[model samples]
Target: MSAAKIGDINLYEILGVEFEAEQADIRKAYRKKALECHPDKNPDNPKAAELFHELSRALEILTDISARSAYDKVLKAKKAAEVRTKQLDSKRQKLKADLEQREKDASYIQSYSTVPKTDEEVLQEQIERLRREGSKLLEEEQRLMREQLVRTMLEHQYAQAKTSCDSSAHRIKLKWKAEKDKSNGGYSYEDLTIFLKKYGEITALVMSKKMGSALVEFKTLEAAEMALTYEKGRLQNPLHLEWVSVPGVKVANETRGSILDYEDLVMRKLRQAEERQRLIAQMLAEDEAEG
Candidate 1:
């Protein structure tokens, strides 16, 4: 085997080591050489300047795991090529011997001979077989490549989502409270309308006299944060402010139900009507007793 040629003073030579040297040895070598060839110490020598640059490159590769792995692959391929050359020589010798033996036996054929398929037919069969094998291999390779691409995309998305969540500056929570006026019956639709006009938008209003509360969602954490801040001490007559951030606000209905439902307002009006009727009935009973 010919000795490996060294040309153009490269990183390995600048570090005074073989290409396959361990990282620790590379580092030690770099430190020694960097001190010796540092431009400040070797100001008069152009060669020292070149050597310093080469040492820098060597240290960069040695310190980086990925760069070192890539360089190692190159060395492995070179070694594999040498092994393949020896194997090819052995294969050629065996094939030559087999052909010679076949040629000698060619003359011992039987007199009764049957016609074989034409060369073109044999060639066509071989071509078809190869085509089928190639097609299967291509499909398998394509599937694997697609799977790798999908995994890469998912990793990218997860990284982006993580970054966004980490950088968020504010957090907001929603709170709900239910209030009733038994004397007036139920709450008024007019009051809710006036509230929504004053407030940005109503997120949700569910009315079952048994349960009355609004579920409001904000577009941004900042907006929600602001709303919770400003509305803390504010009160409208007959309605006081009580806020808490609780979980279990159904997200899907926030979009759909908000558009369709006016039930909360309607129920409030019904309750108020019931309260008014009760008061009127009581007054009439008192008047009849006096008469």
Candidate 2:
């Protein structure tokens, strides 16, 4: 290699050895690399001859004591120059970033710098803002009231429908107080059979051993109603009658005997919403008339 190209060439890299490698290690690396790119071994490759010559030259420079020392000086100078160039580039980038930030700050200040509003104009703006806020608050209040009214109406309707359905059904389930006597665990199916049968001909009797309750299905609706009148059936414990809750039963009118098939719950929800809107409109109309 020429003296001018000394900075461009790295002998250690060409020989595939570290700069601090021993002479024996450098020769070993060079031999291994030279075989890979030997002209005879890679006859079809045009770059093989050039690579093989470069490897030979690199090995010659790296192995010689005086030549290796001179090349090391050139490599150090090249690295120093690269570090200085990087430092200068970094400083230039930092200066450019600072200038851009200053320009942005100046632009922002210029955009906001305008003629100040009069006292009356500022007061009018405040009034307009307050008016908008007041209107929003009033709307929010009305929305909340409508939601609350719908919820209350739905609860009332559910209670009324359940009552009507239970009154019309021929089955009644009652919960009895837990027995105080430790000897008797709780009410069994056999214990309450005779007492429940007295009201009417019992179709079915289900005893909940755990809860101490019984569900009696009677042949006639009147029989079920009569059972509720007893309150406590022969047993010392007081009985509380609860209507059976069948799934999908939204209203009493839709039920047939014990088997109930009600309208879609979605329809009921929509109807309740419509009722709430009607009530609100009626109230508004009355208020306007009074005004």
Candidate 3:
């Protein structure tokens, strides 16, 4: 019976008979299976008819003496191959299952354990973030540092400037005599104070009348020069503005001037005026001679 290959599905297993079964045994098994799988008996099962045909074919092949002998050698080889295939298949499936289990175990261990960061990795992460964000952080830090340095330098320079201004010649005393006055009220302190405020910063005010003039002190040299040389400005009745020295008493009283200080101031001013007039007269004489 050169019907099928040796390694195909076993016919004995299909017929429910052992490999060592007798012909009578094969016949009995075949009859039982044919009845169970018959078209008339199992009308609802479509495969029943096909199974009946295959079983009948198997029975015919096995019951004949010559066919059975030929099939027995092939069947033995088929059984051995089947056994080897089943062993190899089982081992392969088991190895696949073990590999899957190992992967699952590794994943579980890694999920709970944290990877410690290396310095290079941390630096690399920072580099990546900086690439995305640009150099704004570095620029902001530099800007802040520059601002702080500027502020510190400005504060120091401001302090030095303030000290120099304080120590320098900001104060200048001014003496002025009225050219023509009714003596009723030639220069009132109130009017002078208000007028001076428009031009410069004034910290203190003093008026002295004992020296036949008013002695005034300004907080700034520019203010004293302005009051002395202004073309249209005057205290009252043709005021003669002159530079003088700062006196000991700050707020000089017009009605009660000290005797020694008043006399000295008067003499000094009179000498200065006479010397100035002499120089002017000499200059005028020289000019006329040249002409």
Off by over 4 Å in 2: 90-291
Candidate 2 per-residue lDDT over residues 59-170, each given as its tens digit: 6556556556666766777787577657777778678668869976776677667746433234344334434444343244335544544544455555554543332235
Cα lDDT of all candidates, in order? 0.45, 0.58, 0.53
Residues 45-127, candidate 3, lDDT per residue (tens digit)? 99998887667656655665544565666567657756765777777868866886997688667766785543333434443
Preferred candidate (TM-score higher): 1 or 2: 2
**Best-performing candidate as measured by lDDT:** 2
Model 2: how far residue 94 lies from native, Å: 16
How well is each residue in 77-159 modelled by candidate 1, as lDDT tens digits? 55665576567677786786687578546633531445464333333443344344443432443355445444444444444
| Colliding pairs, model 3 | none
Please give the distance, in angstroms, between residue 26's alpha carbon in candidate 3 and its true position after superposition: 1.1
For each candidate in turn, give its C-alpha RMSD to the true structure in angstroms: 24.0, 32.4, 44.6
Q: List clash counts for every candidate, in order.
A: 4, 0, 0
Ranked by TM-score, the better of candidates 2 and 3 is 2
